[model samples]
Structure formats: structure tokens, C-alpha cells
Target: MLLNNLTKKFKHWLPLAKSKIEKGASQLENSINNYDPKEIIPSKLIERLNTKLNSLPVYESYYDTLTINVHDYIHQWIINKEQNRKNCLVIKGNCVDNLYNILTSIFSEKSSLSKETIELDYQIFSLENLKQNRRDRLNYLQEKILEIQQQSDKKIILIPDLSYYFSRTIEGLEVLEKLLKLLDEDENKFWIIGCNHWLWLFLVKIYHWDAYIENARDLPLLSQENLQDILLPVLDLVEFDWNDLRRFLVELPNQNEDDHKIISQLQAKYFENLANLSQGCLGTASQLCFYSLRYVKNEETELSNLKINNPQLPDFPSITQSDRYLLFCIGLHGHLNKSDLANILGDDQIYITSQIECLVNLNLIHFLDHQNIAINPLFYSKLTKDLKDNHFLVESD
Candidate 1:
């Protein structure tokens, strides 16, 4: 009886032990096969941090109202011109990005009219070749205007950044005034001009640009919905994992039908926060989104395991009286080279250099090129408001 009982127990234990051995072999094989010589395993804390950053939005598109309105304006202008009306359209905006979008949209043949649209980057052209070819620049513009005037088919002449040539000096302002007068005299060609709102304001005070271009429109501010529309389409093109994003806040071993609903609500809130933080400025919103994605607390860690924090607007440093004046000067001109800034401030280059470096470190301004510096777009709208409130800018009637 004892022998028979022992035989039965062994029979039962044999299969159980074999199953355990097979499971162990399978796990060992997986470990060997998955081993990578170059892979560095991150700490649990770092892994958690990286997982958080992967949840934030990445900026992918330039969204705005300017592009759509530009197309509509050009089509309307062409139609108006056909009725023997000689009208010039001036597009003025606070942001250079908006102005650039309008110019590019018109030039890309987005309009209904099939006529040729000639585009000029007066700012870049003036900065590069104007010193050696000032006469050439003027002549070139005149020739384009004259050529478009003679064409039987409707042609549009676009001078984006028209205020680039309008220097604050007496002689420079006079030259710009004369050029506008000449353009105003032309009754044959359809002209579309893009000017910075600040520069436009200054020019109006000096030369009354309203008299020269009777039809002027400000680029409309983009709403939160508009910003969403621009970003979602781009997001669709990429291989984005909603699951990875959802895992950031709530960890579910398996996805359920309600997971989609939860993730959607979270995403909406995230984007809404972004829109509010940027104050409906598309460029600022874009920059903020990009910085959030690219930001890392520790540079030495692997990018895949890096946790990124939501980017916040810089707390602008307290400005001295002189720094306030410097900011106003830059805002007035849109952008200024160091030499031009020195001239405006009536300070020596060495003194100006120290000031500019301080501003740069404070993240109030940035270099556009080797020498030219401009106010940071993120702070531009607020800074302009402060300047106006402090009586630095002239109030409009």
C-alpha cells in the first residue's frame, strides 16, 4: 500500500516539475535574445520623468488667419481693379510671422486669379545690397511697377516689409515719402504692401500713409479654435500613440472602451492651457510647444528616457530706465543692428555691447543675424502694451 501511494504522488509531481523547467528555459531564451550591448537602462525615476514629457504636444505647423485673408484680399483687389478702380492694399500686423505668411500665401498662387504676382523682400534686399545698390533698389522697384502697369493681364506687385527702407533720419524718411508718392501716382498697377504695425504707426505720424494707401487692413488675431484647427491636421500625419500619452497620467494594464474618452478630455485641456499661455499668438504658442518637447533637465541622460517639463514664459528681468529706453527703440524699428542701435542710443559700441548682452541673457531680445537684434516675439505684445501704458508710444485717435 505504501509503494502504490508513493508511485501516485511521483506521477503528479513529474508533470508539475517539467512545466516549471520549460517556463524557466523560455524566460532565459528571451533574456538572451533581447540583450543589446549599447542599451543603457535608466533608473526608475528617470524613466518616470521621460514618460511624462512624451505626453506633451509637439509644434508642427504655423496656424493663423493671415494666410486665408491674404488670398481673399488679393482676389477682391483684382476684381476691383477690373472695374477701373485703382486701389492699393496695405496689410499691417504686429507680428512679422503673420506678414511673412500673407506674402508667401499670395505668392504661392492660392488666389483665384491666375495672374502673375511679383514678390519682394525689401527688408532683406535693403539690408544686403542697399548700401552698394540704393539706386538699383529704387530703379528695380520702379521698373517692376512700370512693367506691371503696362501688362494687359492683371498683375499684382507685392512689397513685403516695405518699412525696411524707411530710416529714422530726415533724409531717409524723405526718400521713403517720395517713393510712396510715386507709387500713389500710378493708377494702372495693383499694389499690395506689407508693413509692420509699429512702423506703419510711425510712418503715419510722419507721412500719413493712410493718404497714400486708402485701403488698409490689420491682420486678424487668431482664436483658440483656429489654433486647434492648425495643429490637429499636422498631428494626424505623424504616427502618434494615444496610448503612450494616456499612460502618462493613468496607468492601465489594458485599454478599455472608456480609455479614448479619458484621453480626449485630457488632450483638450492640455491644448487649451497652451493657447491661453500663448495669449492667442501663434508664433509664441509654437515656440512654447517646441521648447516643451526639446527641453531636458539632464543632458547626459538618454533622450528616449528624458522627462520634459512644460515650458513657462520667462519672468522678464527688472529693467533699468536705460534698458526700458533700449527696448522701446527696438520695438519702434522692428529690428536694429548694433551699430544702428548705438546711433539711436547715442552711446559708444562698447557700452551698447554690454547692454545687448544683458538683454540677451535675460531673454528679452535675440540676434536676428550676425549684428541685427529684435525683441523676442514671446514678449513683444506685452512689451508693446507696457510701452503704450507708460506713454512711450503715441496714442491713436
Candidate 2:
């Protein structure tokens, strides 16, 4: 009877023992990515954080906005907008260059017509300057820019994104070659052309593309102060508890007196580390900032409903080998639609479509539109490292 009772207890406890072992193993894996999450943060927290970020007016898409006395990344061009001569600019992409933000900068200059000019041209070229579109905006922009060009001794011609002109396909090669011919021959116009750094490298390898447009300047890497300035608009709009970043409350028995001083120091350190981790990419740093934000929803005290989740580098473990190469290709091109990806990989378009859909669901990739997909900025750094580890060629982040 006693033996029977012991067997029953053992049977009851076995499943619990097994579950604990499995849970421990799961935690071990998480530790490799980030400190074994001290708590299981519900997915809703991130959703809520995103909602709060979107609610802010100035927190527009990835371009650092026109707040804090800032224009877009085109500061030099803005300063020298009137140098009326046959000068040209080639903006080599550093991070995912959002051409729309470039338009916004021109808008900020009170040259709304100039913004329209760029918008129209981009529409004519293709979706994001890559696909086929039958919009009249293209014609309107071309006419407007030319009109402006004829009026001023020197007006700017901005090709916001060169990536839009071609894809990783046979026709794309012909299109880019033609574009090179245009750049070489159009010596009478003041022009500024932008291309993704990865895509630029690929073009250089294939067609010696840079030979046509010499001396492309890279977008500068932002420093801590620069990142802070970029996000100043969000900082004002978003509510975060400065107190949460304070360290060692237990160690500081008389902490109240030094609270302000400590918090100020921590705030500076926060952005400094953020700049380092994001490698000075404004878009990447912005996402990391959002990821670190949490809403406590408290209704008491000055900052009752806020906290800082210490920022950590995203270390996704579930990314597979195929995912790595697909991401590399996207990085190489700056963006790719399903069909574009299919053509490059020589895989069935249907299969390519499903794979990208799965990646989007997993949040490893995001859509620029209904068709074009790009790597999520948050994952770019890790993807770069993973590619290097696998002995794949990767450009600088």
C-alpha cells in the first residue's frame, strides 16, 4: 500500500518536474540574447508603446524631423541652396534613407513647389522610385523642376532615391545604365541624387556606377547629441519618468537631494549608449528608443505612469539561415518587393511571397508599401553581424 502511494506521488510530480526543466532551458537561451528577461513583458506593452509614439505629431516616419531647429539630413544643401551653378551632389545612403523626409526638408525651406517637384518625379519613376506607375504627378514634377530650373540661374534637381529607378532584375540593369548616361551628359544642371549605401556598392561592382558620378558624400553618422537633437520633438511629446533610470536607491539613503543631478547624468549616458548601439543611424536609434519605453498607466505622482526598460541590443535567436541571406539581399538593395526578391534568388515568385509574408509576421521585415519590403532597422545591426559570422559579404551598417 505504501509503495503504491509513493508511485502515485511520483506520477503526479513528473510533469511538473519536466515543465520546470523545459522552462529553465528556455531561459538559458534567452540569456544568450539578453539577460534572461527578468519578467515576461506582454506583447501589448509594445503595441501600446507604438501607439504612444504614433500619437505624437512630429514623430513622423524614420527621418529626423524639422524640430529643434533641424531640417532633414540635407543641411549642407539647405545652406547652399542658392549657389546657382552646375554643382552636383550624390548622397550615399548610410541608414535606410527615407526620400519622403528629404521632401519634408525642402518643404521646411518654404519651397513647397520644390517639394512638389521631387514628389512628382518620384511618382513617375516607380513605386518608391522602383515600380511602374501611370500617375500625372511625374509629368507635373518634371515640368515644374524644369520650369524652376529655367527661372533661377541655378535651382536644385533632387532625385530623392536612386533605388527607385531599378530592381535586381535584367531590366533594372538597362534602366540604371541609361540613368548613368543621363548623369554623365546632364552637365548643365544642379543635381542631388541619393542611393542606399548597400545598393550603391552593388552598382559599383556591376557597372562601375560611381565612375559616372564622382565624389558621393556619405550621410554623417550621428553622435549622442545629434541623436538627442533628432528626437527632441518626441522627447517633448512623449512622457518618460527621468527617475526610473536612477540607479541604487537602496544605496542612497539621502537620495532626494541628489536626485536631479543623478537623473541628468543618467539621461546623457542613455543617449550616449544609444548612439553607440545604433551606430549613429537616426532611424535605428529611434526604434531602439521606442522599444525601451514602457507605459505604467499609473494615475498618481508627477511621473506615475512611466518607466525605462534598460535598452539592450536585439539578439533574435529564431532567425534561420535562409532568413539571413534574404535579409542580406534586402540590405544590398535597400528594399525589394516579393517579385524583385524572387528574380534575384531565382526562386518561384509564389514561394518568395509566402516567405516574406512569414518574415513580416515575425517582425523581422516590414513593408515600405503593399509590395516593397525592407529589413526592420532594429534588426539591421544583428543581421549584419550574423551575415559576417556566416562568411557572407556585408557593407558597413
Q: Which candidate is the best by lDDT?
A: 2
Q: Can you give the lDDT of residue 235 in candidate 2?
A: 60
Estimate the TM-score of every prediction. 0.63, 0.64
Identify the leading candidate in terms of TM-score: 2
How many clashing residue pairs, candidate 2? 2
Local accuracy of candidate 1 as per-residue lDDT tens digits, 16-107: 45544554465457558754434333334333433333333322222234444545665666566543234566777664344544454444
Residue-by-residue lDDT tens digits, candidate 2, 352-386: 55456556655678976677788888877776667
CA shift of 75, model 2, Å? 16
Clashing pairs in 2: 129-164, 130-164
